[model samples]
Target chain A: MSDANDGAATVHLTLDEVRALAKAGLAKTGLSPDHVDAVAETMVAGERDGCASHGIYRLLVAASSVKTGVVVPDAEPVLDEPSPALVRVDGKGGFAQLPFRLGAPLLVEKAQKYGIAALALNNVVHFAALWPEVEKLASEGVVTLAVTPSHAWVAPAGGTEPVFGTNPIAFGWPRPSGEPFVFDFATSAVARGEIELHRRAGKPVPDDWGYDPQGNPTTVAEDVLKGAMRTFGGHKGSALAAMVELLGGPLIGDMTSLQSIEADGGRGGSPIGGEFIIAVDPAGFVGAMLGEHMKHAEEMFDTITGQGARLPSQRRYEARRKSLTDGVDIPAALMRDIEKLLEEA
Target chain B: MSDANDGAATVHLTLDEVRALAKAGLAKTGLSPDHVDAVAETMVAGERDGCASHGIYRLLVAASSVKTGVVVPDAEPVLDEPSPALVRVDGKGGFAQLPFRLGAPLLVEKAQKYGIAALALNNVVHFAALWPEVEKLASEGVVTLAVTPSHAWVAPAGGTEPVFGTNPIAFGWPRPSGEPFVFDFATSAVARGEIELHRRAGKPVPDDWGYDPQGNPTTVAEDVLKGAMRTFGGHKGSALAAMVELLGGPLIGDMTSLQSIEADGGRGGSPIGGEFIIAVDPAGFVGAMLGEHMKHAEEMFDTITGQGARLPSQRRYEARRKSLTDGVDIPAALMRDIEKLLEEA
Candidate 1:
């Protein structure tokens, strides 16, 4: 049941089984059935694509947040028609998944109808990667960009204290066939979990990953967890992070990461905030030349791969292909944690 | 006139004088009078913002490109309304400056009318920073994002050869008062000009800035200029650069960086490619609450600066404020080269 070397164990589960497990755990949190269904799909996608950290592992975070009363378990999300080309979804302080799901169709429709569209989801507890949202839009034949600000756990490039989130930006581009090109990444040099893992393993973190309580760069993971993290690429990443805050926060008429964390009230729950999504139809720009333009995109891909450079999401897509045939493996302890939630419910 | 140590000579001129010089040199390129006026504004803006490279120094490059017939000095830009929300401008192989100028008003108008709009500039010779375009849109009280791919001079992360451009991403947000917030930066670790400057000074480049011909990381700026530069933030920046290429190139139905470079036929002129720009009107998202949302934005900025973290465009804005009255300094040697062009005309 365990791998002694890493003190870990895994359990294999088919894609359907993973979804069922996620749904059960989400249901245990008293989320509405329809909302649970929407959120579970993203969890399954994460697992299928080898993003174990964002996969069913998030079920624990969700359940815990609901129990802490930081996230609304069953509040219905409300869609707002802000403009012809702007869609706003008030999550009603619930999880962002359902609101995003409800808004996406309209976003895609608006993009096709108006050439471009923007979606803003506010008053939501965010606990998922942005890729799922962008990917969904891309599948509907559009280019998508999504961004969100997490809890302010990272510092600006020149600042000693935390002033920005481990903000993430996700982008997706539709392909002529097969899986879309997608990338979702945090601006933080490293994720908080990575530092926690290092701490658990009694190892030092890499420089630039984080700083000590004194605000000086340190490799001590524990200190960083208690202090602050740094953004990737220093100031450049900081700039991007600030941009995320502006777009997903104030622009969306929602809370900044600092405000989001304060709303959490030291509960260490999922950050309560907003998300910004933009969708653009290729047809709007290229019209009948869509196919021709897509071919040009493929040429770009070929050159990147031909030079032995892998495009973003290529490995994830590859993992997905294999996992679709061969079921995914979930860490046994994590599976046990999910089962615990179901049992409690 | 020469600085003893760096061998750089300075020439101080009023902003009016700078514009006159720029217009004179641009006229010598056989550019249309109106196009010259449009392009000259951007050049003057660069100088006033203390960006010497993008300032009047670019005049020499423009004149040389026109001389080689690689750039269409007098080509008229054609605008097409592909859709109610999209504006396409065929620069007809001329400077992007003129195309952008002709397209800006339409872009702003559409953003206001439709809430969101796109402006695509194709078949253009680009020789300027993207800030001016975004800033202008911001001046019109809208949020803007602009991206473009330069010639392929950068390598993808973990790749050995060049497969990407020093692609830049620029963003602008309108402020309640004062100038709008703006940032434009290349995804490359550093600009190609920085490496060339280092090479000229017989200095070694920093690690991760570039690689040798074999693709191994190197500190020799010369090797990097001949081989390939690396993207900033390693893989994250690489992903961003690829996104820029997709959104600005194929998405706009124009040439990719590699294609653009090849189209140049080794003339080493400005890259003939396309630019993609998006503008969003705040009123669409926040309605009459636009002022309230912007106040939230100011709060975010306050925290960043309150913690002593400088915002991305603060320095440039500060430079502009001072230079507006104090004027800007130009290198004496560069001025000589530009004046020589006027003499030849």
Candidate 2:
């Protein structure tokens, strides 16, 4: 490993090396070999794509979840097609990736046949970044929208108490001839993990990011972690968060954000919630006009980028390209923590 | 009319009186009887629900569009089912309500059979609020998501140029045994019409609402009208606006936001854009669990509202209920404008 210095020490490791380390660390948690590989692949992509919070930083949590029996290491998801265009997957208390991996092919097939399809996952633990799932579908030429709810950490616009999750939503649009455009974001002003990272670094957040424990706006990250995160865009972002809570929770027969938190008793592991994924095929509706459609989209992109505007995923794509050649840089402390886990295993 | 004095002259009129005025005012625009009725119903609902920007304030523009040969007053939309779960409508240059009125029933029917359905409208001039379309579907126990793109009025987060539309999106969810929950909002920090209203009233807007012509944030509404509106949640809202642009424009073989502006030669009328609506039946997947699903959602609403957090559309519903009894309050100046149009007819 090579060390890259900014203010803190960071270690650069090849993608394959990181994947091997993740797999080795997770395998000892009693996960099946296939489960271990799936989790490792997801975390590797997270690191490669520059989402450090969701990358190797989460491996220890996964291991602890397995050891605490919160996540069943060898559980299998059951897939059912309730309708021609609707799929339901019961994750059976397993990692979210397992269900998505089991059901994505079927979702693509249905979308190809029916023009659109919806997949709902229940009783799943979503621990990875959401973009990988939608981006994978987009790679197969499918436009996808995915959403999931976590523990309640965000407050409504005018209220002080937490009633919603960070509630991330992801969208994927496939280009006619190249990589898909993907964007995933938490509806809150800032992701909870980012605040935690700020707190760990002993830094203050922006005033708009969250409220303190007394329900007053505060810049202290530690204060915000003890209080609640504010939704982005005031009332509008709050509405979107509520939409995710409804779609991912009640609509899917799973736990709402508050329910998830209460049930888990804040064990600091992945929450047992639901995920909703919808896939649509452009060719299904546009048919021969698909090229024209894509051309128009490209024109919009060109006009915007020509004026120096960046698309949501443009920076991530650039980071990924550089990582492919220069390797992924992980925080030196986190690298040490993973190594300790590996040694123990 | 009873005048309510508050800085400006406002008049209270019964819902029936407002609908009658809207129907009479729209009838002179060369629209067919059915088209006029549909437009009137949508406008009346907008006023009754307290969205004054989308209510009587827009009648003059709608009539002008029809008179200038931009909107085809009598044209009929043609509905086509490209797939079992997809319904396509060609608006044939008509008012937007025509297409929804013609295709919504089909969308509902198909959603009943297929568990999910999508309606794509092309060449439509959308001049009314979007909630009506989705609210109608929710009334029939169908969950609906609707989106439409207007002319370029919003700038990308980090860019100065206007490349995206205000691009409103609406979502509706039906309760098991009551009125549905619905919300509609523009991706921009504030709707363009509201800014124009503020300009008319000679009031300054919040600095975050928009930018001046020099790409600097400004509170002057007139400068914002000359410049561009900012997205609500910065990059997140900008990404959503882009999503609506793609889904409603290129994906449906229609014009992009800037393309619509150029096509109209900046006539300041409603643009011929596309609309996308998706409907899903909860019972199709959850079956008997639908009630349980709704119970969880109600609990969330209760807990949030109990803590004084208002859900989206809660105020709208309350306003509508009061309007049904105490009548709708409209600005006297707007009422006079409508009466003048009616008198000319």
Candidate 3:
């Protein structure tokens, strides 16, 4: 939040500095070399894209899981192609990033050959945003929808207790130029970190964000966190959350959010589950007309932006551009937390 | 709507009668024999499932399209397989239902063989709820996601003018027994018909529904119809709507909502475009564990219903059960409208 080098709450750091600090902190937890690199890449990406909660702040959570021995840092992911268009990656209870990295190529190849394909990452300790996954695939000229369930921290619409996760759905579309259009969003009214931030600041959340233990709407962030969080757009958002649970959970042979928590045994570590990512190749569907259709999409974007409306991914792309040149800034408090993780061992 | 067919303004009819009337009315429009049967089935299903808006009321829209030559009543849908797992159905500018019916078997076969498959229906006049499509596939024991863009009537979250369609997204997951878990919803704050109903009744909608011509949020339904409608849940809904546009439009080599409107040339008929449906076979992913995973899904459903949180598709299934026994009701005014359509030449 600050560019000044003075003693401020916000501290400025170059991209390289962010990477080195992230690597150092993760390494302190005995993360495998290649796995650490895969995980650290997502960390740097989060900082570059200004998703601070998903940035180096997650290193503490990773270290906590490491302390619990929940994540298999050196586990080698096993890939299985049960059917022509389906690629399943068994993460062997390790971090998700490496498994996705190892399986994405097969997903791409399948989509190229079959017009559409899906990658299922099972038994992974997931702890990061899904945009990095979709973003990388979109850069490879594929349209994708990626989803995963988290802890059972959210409630279904019209329900009194938690029955679903803050299940996030990320979508990516390859643009003819510039950054490919992308969005990664939790189906909940807001991310869990949002309520946490509100509670940390002693602030009241919006009425729609969550509910009290009785299922009645509440503004107190801490009470709601202890109770249940609502989904965005009411029942429609809840339906999407259910889809994420079904697809990323039982559909792909993995744990549901409830099962994930049950498996954690109250340790409160990162959720160990599965992810479902679907990729589509434009050429396979359109043959030679891909260019003309792509131009039409460009016009659609222009119409949206020309009317003073912002695309969902525009801000992150802007932050990414600026961060590439101007580096990034983090709270001094967060830096202290990272230092604590490094000091633990 | 009333169950009393006496002197009141409502009429009651059995499912059989509903089907007969629907078939007669569609046939009166010179619709092809097979097409009439296929379209009539959806009409009956809509009425049986208590989706009154999508029920026999659509006969009027179908008749209007027939009069305008926008829908080719005799059009025979053509199917082409461009890749191993992609089935493209060209509706030849006919209704979407028939094309989907003609192509569904191929989609199922592909999903069975490849683990995942996609069906893209192009150049069709879609006028029904997507539940029936997903429900059909879900009954066949495959998971499905279907999306289609309609006429441009909704605005992006930050924009004032219409740039996107209602853009419904539907999902279906196979349950262990009984009906599958299914949901189909528009990304808009509410369906376009809701606003139209409010306008006809001279009622004020909620503030969240739409905006005035100047982009100010307005409860006046008429003004919003003339201006722009907002997506649900602010930016998150807008992003999902955009995903629908991209996937149902350019990615499938079909017209965007804007292009569909431009091509409509103010006829105000149904927008002709594409529908994208993805089918995933559970057995391909889970193999022998399918039954075990399915039992887990049942437990998940129990958790949902145990909390008094109704599943998205529960209402329709309930209506279906009741309708099969008692029948459905409609306003006398709607009956007269259908009579007028049938009486036209």
- The predicted structure with the larger lDDT, 1 or 2, is 1
Interface RMSD values for the candidates, listed in order?
A: 1.1, 1.2, 0.8
Q: What is the lDDT of residue A202 in candidate 1?
A: 92
- Categorize the docking of model 2: medium
Tens digit per residue, CA lDDT, model 1, B1-345 = 112113367888999999999998989889889878988998899888878778887788788888899888789999999888899999999999889988999999998888889999999998899999998899988889999998988998878688788999999998876688888889999888888788888999887788888888899998998799999998899999999999889898998898888887788888888999999887887788878888878987888889788888888889999999999888777777777788993
Sort all candidates by DockQ, best to worst: 3, 1, 2
The superposed Cα distance between candidate 3 and the true structure at residue A66, in angstroms, equals 0.4
Which candidate do you rate higher for lDDT, 2 or 3? Answer: 3
TM-score (all chains, Cα) for each model: 0.96, 0.95, 0.96
The sequence of per-residue lDDT tens digits that candidate 2 reaches over residues A116-174 is 78889999888887899989999988888898989888888888778888999999999
lDDT of 3 at B54: 82
Per-residue accuracy of model 1 over A129-191 as CA lDDT, tens digit each: 898888888988889999999898888888867867889999999997758999999999987
Clashing pairs for predicted structure model 3, backbone only: none
List the candidate numbers ranked by lDDT, top first.
Answer: 3, 1, 2
Q: Highest DockQ: which candidate?
A: 3
lDDT of 3: 0.89
| Model 2 steric clash pairs | none
Instruction: Provide the global lDDT of candidate 2 against the true structure.
Output: 0.84
